[model samples]
Target: MTIGFSSRTSRVARVAVCCSAVCTLAALAVATNPEGAGLPFGTGAQDAKAGQEPPSLYRPGTQARPRAGAPRVPRDVSAVSWLVADAGTGEVLAAHNAHRKLPPASTLKALFALTVLPGLPAGLRHTVERAELAGVGAGSSLVGVKENRTYRVADLWRGVFLSSGNDAVRVLAALNGGWRATAEQMQDKARSLGARDTRVVSPDGYDAPGQVSSAYDLAVFGRAGLRNAEFAAYCSTATAKFPAGGWSYDIQNTNRLLTGAGVDRYPGLIGIKNGYTSKAGNTLIAAAKRGGRTLVVTVMRPRTGGGLAVYEEARSLLDWGFRAAGRVDAVGSLVPPRPAAAPQTGPESPPVLEEKEEVTGPGWPAAGVITGAAGLGAAAVALALRLKSGRLVRD
Candidate 1:
């Protein structure tokens, strides 16, 4: 007992240093305050604790345990932003630039599906309107939703999950009302899910002027999405038949990790989403289970590798996360949804965050008051670990 107390006191003295880092991260949501970051000011973000926003995520580089027994985070991760988390427990195994917002690409569709799928019944069929397909961005992916063809909601979702179809997303958004309203509802849904970094300018996740999300937010979406049965079925769906003009044909999931279409099929992979654009590079959210443990990994814009790097990086990270589990400490946690409460005000029609400055490194001097939150929010910083800094994707 004497030995244990001595060890504890020394460890506490060391970790007290990083308390400031988590404090900066808590204040990093300056945009979340008055401007609201598409969220109501008091969505409990400031009050959130218990590693709700893990401190090391702001390290601007790789984060891992320094102790001898702790599994190291993969050195070659190379993505601009990445995160590996326990889907079952919401413990973030590790992260890099976890909340540094960037364009999300089609991975945003997971949130779209999560937001809209619950309300629309699978058996409900709607005829495709020309207007619904009209606004799909040029060169956006398509699951071939043809105009005037009646499609069951299930079919549209199959198109979305299998093909990453912007056309299908537009149609689904229209059925939810219109693209704009669906975007609002998506924003509301994101805030409710504690995904503050996401700004859903297009339900399809096209690279609009201000459209962006972070690897951390994507992991949150993936973890929450798996909890919903329909979302899980759609994402895990490898292939499905779609109706054409008078016939039907098959479509395959673009998430190569799930289907192994062109990339190596990751064993025990769960279907999530993948996306790319000239602007976003490559982005993915992948989940897999092994030994009864499921891990979710999100990679946004790996800048250092081949075209399939997103899946490869996700696979590698998932591998590391499993290896690092319990060996390395959780840097943070996936915060649960804020309890429903009346907003201080109504939804602002426009996205509130359009910050010009980016937090490319740690301690970039952000705004907001972080009291009682910066220190060990979810779990204490790993006592045996020492952080090392490194510098670093797309989609």
Candidate 2:
């Protein structure tokens, strides 16, 4: 005797079964390798020592790992290391091999700007001497500022951001009392910002033997640089005139995200920086604002055989970050500076918010989700399960 229900009932049963199967597989997958399930931040064993792995933002005794219900993390990004973070809160939303050190190219200029912009008066004008222009690396991008021409600090900044000008960096570094001092200051600033992986051997971010930075550090620089009005203005300026003896040259921003004239132009795109060299591949630190939220994305060493893959990858991470903003838990937070010690002889001061570092294991599993593209496949399975569960209940 055939024991079959009506067609509608049969269809519902099939869907319910399919959904259950999908959900079971997804659950099994997550159980077997929770680290590989596309959760943004780490929810793994903590190492005793700091710096072993990227720290987690989720506090102890909380649900620190990414859940199956979390938004599907993007997996098509091709950078060797990348990170996306909430610009205001310093929360690291997603990362892939974020601490892996590599050549930063011109993206390090953001750090240069952060370190030096605070010291130079915006209106300070200095005549460019031949000596100031010397030692610019061969084939470095330039803004064509001729020697013996006076440029305001603001204009030199424009040259720096608009053209990724190594010459501008040199000029500014000289003004700051030579490249060595500037480099030392930049490295100090990086350390203060919790960017431990950065070592600034060149003020202009040239390909030096030990000039290295990580995606995490670049994001740190981007966030810090954007806090300065002048830095923000310089990076956002799409075009400006650079004065030379009698003729002025119009320089345009090298960051295509802000200009909207490239392979992709993002709305609310602001100033940051981009870089490429034979050794560094392609690097970008991008920022954008939407609905009162600002996001910074850093991509490094993206496969660059063709079109603006760096920009495209940056845009993708930005889109994903916006979509995932409030949906996923922060895997980590950018460590804030330690509060200044109170003066020993001063009046009682307000309590300062103490910063703590959350440690993760040597094999930080959260990286597995961010770095491995296969996490999205598990997300697909989880989605199928959710759909099936809903349909079954309706039936």
Best model number under lDDT:
1
Give, for candidate 2, the lowest lDDT window spanning 10 residues: 56-65
Candidate 2, 13-45: lDDT as tens digits: 566566556655554555466444444464343
Error of 1 at 7 (Å): 51
Write one digit per residue (lDDT tens) for candidate 1, span 220-274. Answer: 9999999999999889989889998679998999999998977889999987999
**Quick one: best TM-score, which candidate?**
1
| Clashes found in each candidate (C-alpha, N, C closer than 3 A) | 8, 1
Q: Which stretches of candidate 2 lie over 4 Å from their true place?
A: 1-68, 304-307, 337-395
If scored against the real structure, what TM-score would every candidate get? 0.73, 0.71
* Angstrom error at residue 69, model 2: 3.8
Write down the lDDT of every candidate, Cα atoms only: 0.81, 0.78
- Give each prediction's root-mean-square deviation over alpha carbons: 17.1, 18.1
